[model samples]
Target chain A: MRTLVGNHGWATIAAPGNTGNVADFLVCRLIGSIFICFSAILSGCHAPLSANNSSRVEITYWRTLTGAAGEGQEELVRRFNNSQNEIHVHCEFQGSYSDLAAKLFTAAAAGAGPDVTQLGTFEILQFARAGLLVDLKPYFAGPEAINTKDWPGTISTAGEVEDGLYWLPFNVTVPVLYYNEDAFNAAGLLGPPTTWDDFYLYARKLTVRDDNGVVREAGVALWNITWPLISAIWSEGGKLTTRDYGHITLDDPVVLKVMTEFQTLVREGAALLPDEASGGHRAAFKNGRAAMILDSPAAFQEIFAQAIGFTPMVAAYPAGKNGKVYAPGGGGLVLWAKNPATNRAAAWRFLRFMLSAESLAYYSQQTGYAAFTESAQQVMTNDLKDSRFGVIHDGLRFVRGDFSINMSPSVRNAFDEAFQKIMVDLADVKTTLMEADAKAEHAIAERGI
Target chain B: MTRTSLKACGIRRRPRCIASQWRSNRSEWLTFGAFVAPNLVLFVTFTYWPIVYSLHLSFLEWDLIEPSAVWAGLGNYARILNNPQVWRVASNTLIYAASVVIVAQFLAFFLALLLNLKLRGQTIFRTLAFTPYIATTAAAALVWVLLLDSKLGPFSFIFARLGVEGPQWLARSGLALVAIILVGIWREIAFATVFFVAGLQGLPPECYEAAALDGATRRTMLWRLTVPLMSPVIFFLNVSGFIAAIKMFDIVAIMTKGGPVYPASSTYVYHLYKLAFRDFEAGAASAFAVLFLMVILVATIAQFRAGQKWVHYE
Candidate 1:
C-alpha cells in the first residue's frame, strides 16, 4: 500500500497526482500505519491488564519468637519478600512469649495492632474468642484456606469452628519425656520409663538424699507440671472439661487415682518442688538434680545447650493405665494487633511465608517447635534433627482434642491455684479435688464463664 | 550645687520606687506561671492521664485484642472486691512491707554504727556491703539461691555440720515467704547502711563530748544523744523504706515468683502485674491498682500523723 501510494504520489502532488517522491512517501506511510495499528492493540489490552494487576501489598507481622528461632524467622521473611513481586512483609520481634501477647492485646484495644502474631497455644483460644482475629474464610475463602493435607490432624482440626478458622500451627510440638542417659545408666535403670507404674517405681529407685535431709536428686517433680499434670488426668481417662463447657471433670475417678498416686509420690519425697537452684526441671536434668523431667519438645534447644553434659533420650508421650495416650500440648500462630487493615495484610503475608516448606524447615531448626507439616520435617537445613527435637514431629501425633482449651483463663488460673494447694497442702486427693471442683464451679458460675 | 542635687535625688527616690513596684508586679505573674507549667504538664500527662484512662477501663470487659473496650459497670470491681484473694494479698503486702522495712532498717542502722568506728577495713566493708544493691535482682537472687541450696550450698553444709537441718528456702511452702523476705532485706539494707553511716558521721561531736563528760557509756550516747540528733535522717529513711517495701516485686519474682504453693506471695503490685500484663485483665487489674493506691494513701497519711510521737524533728 505504501509503495502504491508512493507510485501514485507524483501524479497527485497538486493534480491529485501521486503524492510525493516514491521513497519519501513510502517511509511516511509505513511509520504512520505501524504506530496506529500498535496503539489500537495497546488500548484493547488495557482491561485485562487492569483485571490481573500486580500491586505490592504489605503485612506487618509481630512475633514472640526470640532466641535462636528468631534468627530463622527473619530469614524466612526476607526470602518470602524476595520470592514474591506483589507483596512485602515486615516482621518485628516483640519480647518473650507472654510479653508479645500483652503488647498485641494493648495494640488491638488501641486499634494499632499487627496483622499477625505467633501466639502460644493456651493464649490463642482466649484471644480468638475475643473476636480479635480475621476469619480465614474471608482472606482464604474455604476450609482448605491453608493446604491442610500435610498438617497433623489435631493441629489443624482444633482451629476450625462453625464459622471460620481462627488459628494455624506454623510451628508445633508435643511434650515428651527427656531423660539424662548418664544418670539413668548410673542408677542401673535399663531404659526410660514407659508407663506410670514403671515411672513411679523407677523414680523411687532414683531418689537420693544428702545427709542434710535436702534431696540431692529428686526422681521427678510431682509439684511442677505445666502440661503433664493435665496430661496425667487425660491419660487416666479423665477429661478436663465436659461437652457443655461448664463442668470440671477433674473429679472423675481416674483423675483422682492419678492425683492420689502423684500425692503418694510427693509424700514419699520422690518428687520435689522445683527449686531456684535447680534452674527449673530442664536445668535440673542437665545438672543431675533430677534424672527424669517432662517438658515440651520445644526445649530441645536447651537440651542441645547441655550437649556437653548429658545425652537426652526422647520417647513417646507415655501411655496411661487405661491405655489412653494424651499429649497435653499444642501451639499455633496467631495474628495479633492485626485488628485493622495494613498491619493485618502484612501479617497474613508473613504467616503464609512461614507456612511455606522452606520457611518452616528454616524456622523449625532455629526454634525447637517441631514442624506439623511433613514437608518441613523431612528436609531440615539446620542439621539438628538427630538431636532430641527430631522426635517432635512424630510426638505431635498424640495430641487429642479436649474442649477445655476454650475454658476461660480464670478457670485455668484457678485450677493451677487449686492444684498447687492440693500438692503442698497435703490434702487427700478426693477431698481436695471435690473442694477444687466446687471452687472452680462456683468461680465459673460467678463469672458466668 | 552638690547639696541641691542630693535633695533632688531624695525626692526622686520615693516616686521611682513606686513605679518600679508596679513594673515588677507584671513580672511576678510571668515568673509564677513559668515555674509551675512544666511540672503541671508532666503530672497531667504521666500521672493523671493513666489514672483517668484506667478508671474508665475499670468499667469494661474488653481483652487486649478487641478494637473497643466493652463496658461492664461494677462487674470487674465486684468480681475483685468480692473475692477473698484480694484481702489476702493486701494483708500479705502489709506483712511483706513491714517485715522488710522494720527488720532491714534495724540491721542497717546497727551495722552502720559499727562500720563508722574507724575499723581496720571500714572502706572495704562499706563497698562490699553495698555491692549486693548494685547487682541485678535476678543475678543476686540466683546467687542467694545457689548459696542456700540444701544439697550443694555452703549454708546447708554448715547447718548440717552444726547438727541442724536447713529449711528448703524456696521449695517449702512455709519457708518461701521468709526466704524471699530475707533476700529483699539483705540486698536492700546495704544501701540503708551506707546512708546511716553518712548520717552518723554528720552528728555533732559536741554531743558525744557532752555525753562523755556526763559519764555516759557508748550505749547511752547512742540511745540518747545520737538517736535524738539523727532522728530527721531516720525519719527520712523510714518513709522511703515504707514506700519501697510496699512496691516489692523483683525479690518475689526472682526468688519465689508468688509461689511455694500459695498466692499469698502475690503482693499487690505483683498481682496487679500478673493481671494487667500477664492475663490481660486490664479492667480488673486497674480496679485493683486503684484500690491498692487508696489503701497505701491511707497508710501513708496515718504514718505522718503518728510520727509526731516517735520522730523528733529537732
Candidate 2:
C-alpha cells in the first residue's frame, strides 16, 4: 500500500512481506541506485585530496599572451614540465595586456593571485612601486640565476627598478616597418625607405586616389600615438623625456620636425590615422588599405596569419638625421610577492627554465619576437636563419626601452591627450605640447615618487 | 437519537484532525525551507556580502599590493570632492544619462505608436525593433565601432559617396561621446518600445472611441486620451532608463576607452575603474561607489516624488 508521508510531496510504499513481487523489485532498484550515487559522490570528494598528497606543488602562472605568442608560452611550459618532476606549472592565458593588469589587480586584492604573472615593462614599475612584485635579487643571487650578462642589454635592463630586479625578460619586440609587398610592387617601389624624407615620398607615391579626390588607398598609416611618434623622435635624435626621465622634452625642435612631417602626411591626404576604436594602424596594413605601417615585432605573426593573397614584408624603422633608434616593446615574467617558501622556490625554478636560451629560441620561432640573449641568438641562427623572423632579429640591434619612470603612465596619458589635440582635433602642435608638458609636470608632482 | 449520537462522535474526532493538520503544515514548511536554502545562501554570499564589504572598504586606504589597510576617516571622500577631474566626470555622466533617457524614450515611444497601427506584418517589425535590446551590449558596441569608424568604415564610406566628408566620429573628443550616446539610444530604444507597446495594448479603447466620436484628430486624441493613461509606463521607463544610463559601462569601455584623452569620455564608473584597477586606489574607488549609490538613491527618490504630479494610474 502507498502511504503519503506528512504534508511534504514525498510518498512511500509500505508493502507487507506478502505484497506483489513488482513492488519489491522497484524498491530494490531504488536502493541500489542511491547506493551507487552515494559511493560515486564520496569517491569524487576524496579524489582531489589524494591526488594532491602524492604530487609536487602545482603553481598557477598567468600570462597575457594570445595567438601565436600564447602557443609559444604553452610550449615553453610544456617543456618545463617534461624536464622535471618536482613542480608542475599550469599556465593560463589572461586576455590582452590591459585585461591582464586589471585582473591581476583584482586577484591580488583577493589574495588569490597567481604565483607568477607576465607584466609589461611599464607595469613592472607600477606593480613594483605598489609593492605587488617580489624582488628577484635573491633569485638572481641564488644558484638558479642565469648569467645576466648573456641576455640582451636592451631587454635585460628594461625591467630593472631602482636597486631591485622584479622581472625576468621573456619575449622582446621593437616597432618596425611592416609593408604590403603587393602594394609596394604595384606602386613601383622596389624597396622600403631608409630615411624620413624618402618615407614621406614613398607614402605619397603609394597613395591611390578615386576620381573625386578621395583617397581610395592610403600610402601609410601614421598615427600620432606614443609608439610611432616616439620612433620618429628617436630617429630624429630627439628623446621623449630627459635621460633621467625627470622632465618632458617633447617641445624639442627635432621632435617638432617629426611631428610636422607626420601631420603633413595627414594634411596632404596621403596618410590617414586609423581610429583607435576601429582596429589600430595594424588593421589598415592587414586589410591592404595601406602600403606601410609602423608596428611592433610581436605583430609579425598576426600579420602573416591574416595575410590573404600576399606575403607581407618587414623592414627596420626608417632612420632620421641621427640614426635608427626603435624602442623595444614586450612583456616579461614577474613573480607575485605572496607565496610560500616552497612555492617560491618552485616558481623561481619555473622562471629560470622559461628564460633559458633554448626556450627563448623556441618562443622566437613560434612567435616573431626577437631572441633577446646571446645563446638564444646562436640557437635561432641554427633554427631560423632563413625564416621571416630574420627582419625582427635585424631590427633588434636598433631597439631600446622607452623612458619608463614610476609615473610613466600619467606622463604618457598627458602626451597622448596632446597628441589627440594636434592630430585628431588639428590644434596648434607646439602650443598643445607646451600645455601638455605643464599637465605632465603637474601630474608627476601630484603623483610624486 | 441516531443523528445526535453521530454529532457527538464528529466532535470527538475534530481535535485529532486539527493536530494532524498542524503536523502536516510543519513538514511542508521544512520542505520549502530545504528547497530555497541553496539559492538564499548564494544570494546572500555573493550579492549582499560584496555590497557590505565595499561599504566598509570605503573608509579604509589600501592598495591591493599592501598587506594591510589603514583607516582613513573622510580622506577619500574629501579627495573625490576636491578633485576637478571628478567634477568633469560628473558632468559627462549627467550629459550622457540625460541625452540617452530623453532621446531613447522619445524614439521608443514613437516607434511603439507606429507599430501599434493596424498594419501588415506588425509582428515582424516588432521583432526587428526589439532585436538590438536582446543582443549583447559588448558585441553590438564592437559592431558600432566598425560602423562609425572615421576612415574606411562603411558609414563614412557611404557618406563620402554622397559627397559629404563625414566627421571623425570617434577620433574627435566631444564627438566620440555623441557617437556613444547614439549607440546607447540604439541599444536601449527597443527596451523602451516593448514596454510602451505593452502599455498601449493595455489602454482602454472607450476613451479613444469617445474622442473619435467627438471628431477629435489623431494628434489631439493621442495627446488627450492616450498620453495621460500612458504616463505611468513613461514614468516607469524614465526612472529606470536614467539608472541604466548612469550605470552604462560596456559601450564606453568597448568604444572609446575613455579616450581622445583631451576630451576624455570617462563616465563615473569608468573613473572609479581606473582608480581601483589602474591606480590600485581601492579606498578611493570604494568611496566613489558609495557616493554613486547615494546619487542614484537621491535621483530615484526625486523621480518618485515628481511622478505624483503626472503619473495617472487609470
Best by TM-score: 2
Clashes of each: 23, 0
DockQ of candidate 2, scored on C-alphas against the true complex (2 decimals) = 0.28
**DockQ of every predicted complex:** 0.16, 0.28
Q: What residue runs in model 1 are displaced by over 4 Å at the alpha carbon? A: A1-58, A142-144, A160-162, A209-214, A276-278, A307-309, A321-324, A328-330, A337-339, A342-346, A380-390, A401-403, B1-39, B59-78, B159-166
Residue pairs whose backbone atoms clash in candidate 2: none
lDDT of 1 at B247: 82
**Fnat computed for model 2:** 0.42
**Per-candidate alpha-carbon RMSD to the true structure:** 17.4, 7.0
lDDT of 1 by residue, A1-449 (tens): 24434365454542332323333444455546656876897777432223123566655667766567677677777888788767666678998777887877677676656667676655656666667766665667533355667776565656554466777776666667777677678889988887778888888888887776656677875426436776666776777666344677657787677777777877888776566444766666767767777777677777767744667677655667655455535356666534446445555666776787777777777777777677776777355446555566666666664435343565566666656766676677787777767777776785544
Tens-digit lDDT string for candidate 1 (B67-143): 56778999998999887877877777888888888898899999898889988988999998788889988898888
- Assess each prediction's global lDDT (C-alpha) against the native: 0.70, 0.79
Deviation of model 2 at A185, angstroms: 4.0
TM-score of chain B of each: 0.83, 0.87
User: Candidate 1: DockQ?
Assistant: 0.16
